[model samples]
Target: MTTRIDTRFAELAHKGRAALVTFLMAGDPDPATSLDIVKAMPAAGADVIELGMPFTDPMADGPAIQAAGLRALGAGMTLKKTLDLVRAFRAGDDTTPIVLMGYFNPIYVYGVDRFLVDAKAAGVDGLIVVDLPPEEDAELCLPALAAGVDFVRLATPTTDDKRLPAVLKNTAGFVYYVSITGITGTATPDFGRVAAAVARIKRHTRLPVAVGFGVRTAEHAAAVAQGADGVVVGSALIDVLKATLGADGQASAGTVPAVARLVGELAAGVRSARRAAE
Candidate 1:
């Protein structure tokens, strides 16, 4: 079945531009402000939204994203509340694909069957459980696919040709190519290497490839967008939001606009990729 993610990618392809996928922690600072930030994303040029499912331990996340998760959890954010946030966002916007990104422990605790049901009903289109592997596909990936929710897989620089097929075997929506070797937002990827990596992965699967990790500025996004079908920005946005927070670590008046503005810049950068390639 064609999901919202697939439709969005197809739409962007038709428009001859890469997609700008933005990430934000659910209920960061506060649910109200978080919702407002998310609501403003699409208008700010976000093509797809990856709402973080805040967990106590986010092993794949960098310090910025880790802090964002903490703030969300400290604000009483839960898997259920995260879904509620998506549900709320869906009430107004239905076309922007919402992907719940995080570990699988919460889903295991929340009951995969029930979580899938509620997530689909909540208008969530995809998932990016960083901890889950292809060997454990039965655990969540397969079920997610059966539930019609695209389970996006990650491919790092280390994923060689022998492993690329396995990684893309059941991956849906798109393949997230981690441009760097470490955690999110820690290092900048070599633009030349990233393009080659995207090309190699495309040779393995027909699915769209989105490059993330260390993509911070519009220039960085534009560079990656030259080869990637989508440019994923997370840590930089978290850092932006964190910087805008008040002394008490609560959302300030600048938080939402700050993130929106950055997303707009990144989107413009992504839009310029094809022209730059020409």
Candidate 2:
């Protein structure tokens, strides 16, 4: 059950480190810049990239991500085009892992088995389907595993003690712990509470636990990394991308490099925190 993600990211945990998994909508301003953003992440220090598969109704996302998804949709970005971005990103670098993060409707529309085959072909390592809870994994999980993909799970603070083990059962890649009890982007995570939650989840599963939702700054990344196997940044990064896009509704040339530089800095913060822990 070796996955493209595990091949690249699992080793980082052995070094007392966690991956910096950043999510961004491809083609928010345009496709080429979005692809540049993807390639620039590793240069900045990202161990794995979560290329957000934008959908019209992204219930889990906050304002920033929802707006970003809308912008991407307006740019004519499709699920096919999104996976193609992953394939294009892989052409230049083979090490940094890429995962598709999205809801299930678009994939279901695209046909699950066909989507899995395309995703594998595009060099995707894993998936983070926002709506697919533990009980209904058979919809895509089994086919994903058969395609050599990791069916990642997201455990919230509400996914409590009684239901934790079942949530951990079919998870093969890693467990994404939403740091707060809310949607992506609007969170002010309780680091202590998040740390405790991570510990509790660890008691049930050996899979890496990545914390996400409201992580914005380097200091925030450092703090979250204390109990997380990875720190995921989404809205904050999208905000930066929104900034990079100019006032007149056009993508600026600096958006990709600037976004990469910021995420790289955050990744460094997480790495430095891990070093201090050791």
All predictions: root-mean-square deviation over Cα?
1.4, 1.4
What's the lDDT for all of these models?
Answer: 0.93, 0.86
TM-score of 2: 0.96
Assess the local accuracy of residue 125 in candidate 2 as a C-alpha lDDT between 0 and 100: 89
My TM-score estimates for the predictions, one after another, are 0.98, 0.96
Clashing pairs in 2: 44-264
Q: Which runs of model 1 end up more than 4 angstroms from their true locations?
A: 275-278
Worst 10 residues of 2 by lDDT: 269-278
